[model samples]
Target: MRSQLRPETRIDRCFEALKREGRPAFVTFVTAGDPDYETSKAILLGLPEAGADVIEIGMPFSDPMADGPAVQASSLRALKAGQTMKRTLQLVREFRAKDNLTPIVLMGYYNPIYVYPSEAFLDEARDAGIDGMIIVDVPPEADEELCLPAIQRGLSFIRLATPTTDDKRLPAVLANTSGFVYYVSITGITGAAAPVVSDVRAQVARIKRSTPLPVVVGFGVRTPEQARVIADCADGVVVGSALVETIRTTLGTDGRAGPDTVSAVHRIVHNLAAGLRGAAARV
Candidate 1:
């Protein structure tokens, strides 16, 4: 467990605490049951060891609109194979038995949560050793009902902002954003390429001007150089599609993350970790 004694601190506090200690956090995202439960567990546990400072465990749902083809495909694969919210929480419990301290954040759409009762979902998440929840589709207008309770439960409720979000609306999003505000680097879905680097930097700057919360840039970041570039403007960079794509290619037509999959992800994370460290040095 973290020794700083802010168990109730929002997700941003966790990242801020780490930043004060002079280390950039590595956040990795993976579907709960793309390959299977055991594989999901492996990815979760392996992440911290593989240089991930935080783990974003994806709760698979049928309609993941925020996700691009890579993540959408992964979600479909997991759903087709029968992954549910309950099973995902169970995986968190299993992960906690061995590794107790690393922060685990659940990322997914709101449909699954809507299917289950909200308070019940929060209770289960707390019991499962989850530190936070990222319901991608939940808007700030619904914060009174959703984000507030999550904060009260001592679980961080992270929010997302896209390129289209305006100045007046950005603060509202930041106000409800607990962990770190997930600033989508581009205007489109998760895997689409960011056409201009300057635009992303400007967006990060705009968000930073309005809030003190640490901003983590994500979506369409596919390489170490890209991660490094994005990190220059934000506190953290999140890469999803690229990593998931690695998993897909490693698996043959018959769903399996072969030997190459693990090795590829390991290498990619290792390099990204190094790049983030380098970025931290510049700051």
Candidate 2:
């Protein structure tokens, strides 16, 4: 239904192709300019080849309240390396020059976009080959300010449904939500701990009964086995903090990204993709 009216975007195309393939998508996330731009770009360009169906490019902000320690540190590293809203979008632009098929979603806080002029930012993002967004601080109540405008420009405004989103509040959360709904399986911040498989399965079932949009479970998923379990229960599985932690491990003594930074992330994504692929085959 959301796809019928909006311009055909890479996000929609990617999900549709997965439906035909009878497999769940493996979504990946990384901070732009973490340590430096070139290294982050290498990770970005390498993800899809490593089997990432959708990539969430985080825009580095000075104050990230919703992020966990790992993600917060990554944001600080990116900002220290000069990652701005302009630079983040520019990274997507550079990525689009070579690969235009995999969907890229901008995920972060709202302050940067609001400071950049909402309409102007949307125009530039639409031109930059961005497919969707997940602004954590901006809720459905503020749709007029950013959400609606983004949808009008054909950008999918992905909403987050957490463990606290009850049946009463679920409708409001799903109302303006486009693309796919991100179901945070855990209650706390990112990189905390793995969620119970049965609880997440029940929540995914509940959300699916309410909305036609795909329900992707994320947060606290740190292993290939965990990804496979979540993929079996939900429409997709998103792995972020664990992946960012890998980047952290690859940093040198000076905190600069080492030569193996990109390769480290590639291995994680490769194993996760293989896990989901195997799960899909079993189904």
Return the top candidate by lDDT.
2
- In model 2, which regions exceed 4 Å deviation? 1-3
Write model 1 residue lDDT over 13-91, tens digit each, in one string.
5586777867656778888886677666777677777777778888998888878899999888778777888999899
Runs of candidate 1 with Cα error greater than 4 angstroms are 1-7, 10-14
Error of 1 at 105 (Å): 1.3
RMSD of each: 3.1, 1.0
> lDDT for every model?
0.79, 0.92
RMSD of 2: 1.0
| Model 1, TM vs. native | 0.91
In model 2, residue pairs whose N, Cα or C atoms come closer than 3 Å (at least 3 residues apart or on different chains), thus clashing, are: none
Angstrom error of the Cα, residue 52, model 1: value is 1.1
After aligning candidate 2 to the native by TM-score, how far in Å is the CA of 155 from where it should be?
A: 0.6
Clashes of 1: 2
lDDT per residue, candidate 2, 199-269, as tens digits? 99999999999998888989898898999988999989999998889999999999999989999999999
